[model samples]
Target: MNCVLCLIENDPIAIFGLKKMLEKTNYVKQLEVYEDGEQALHKLKPHLIENTPRTPDVIFLDLNMPIMDGWEFIEAYTAIDRPQNAKKILLYVVTSSVMQRDRDRACELSAVTGYIVKPVTKDDLKHVFEEDLQELWKNQ
Candidate 1:
């Protein structure tokens, strides 16, 4: 099975660019994009009641989004039981904010596997392929 990915980012340029990048990769079979964290959470909530293939193996989350922010999603998601597919989901905080507080807060969230600065590069994505993240992409 190929790996599935999701991006919850409000920036159009960033979403388009990241989608294009993932399309060029060999492993990523699907890419789901959400304009805001709330939309992503709403879609993900259903997985708790029923099985779904839409759950992403890895998530690229933006801290600042309309409706619900990344932190809010993290809180809500963790407050309830997580779906099986989402159990190992690696949610990365991909944001432009370099503030120490934001980074610190993101790291504090159990759902957040890593915190990435804006303009995520090919090297960064490649690095994700290494280390403990190998388990997430390997399942597919």
Candidate 2:
């Protein structure tokens, strides 16, 4: 249950709500927060130098932000020359965008783990866990 996660969001209310839901799972260990994708990139880039457990297990990325949006982040992140063992972030597009186009766009991105619409509840988190995190949990 030592799932380290990150939240790259600008709105304080959304951050608080997401944090509250994540806390309820009792799975997340370190929950890092960034105001934008730029901040997240700045902090996470160095970790890509090598496969390190210090990196986050999952990143709940918002599509829209003040500086450097999700698409920009995905482009930047995928460009990095990561070592083979480096733990690639399981990036999930967590957004309010309900348009089919948005989901299709997210699906087109190879780096994206999945697309999740907000306000993300505990059930959503549970479903995500069931998808892959359950295997990780069992192995742990």
Model 2 agreement with the true structure over 27-114: per-residue lDDT tens digits: 6878889999899899888876765566788888999997899889889988988887676467889999999998998899988988
How do the residues 1-140 of candidate 1 rate in per-residue lDDT, one tens digit apiece?
Answer: 35667888999999988877766776577788888878988887775445567767778889899899988878887776755544467778999999999999889877788988989888878866554468654664
Off by over 4 Å in 1: 48-51, 83-87, 136-140
Alpha carbon lDDT at 62, candidate 1: 91
Q: What is the C-alpha RMSD of each candidate to the true structure, in Å?
A: 2.4, 2.0
Best candidate (score: lDDT): 2
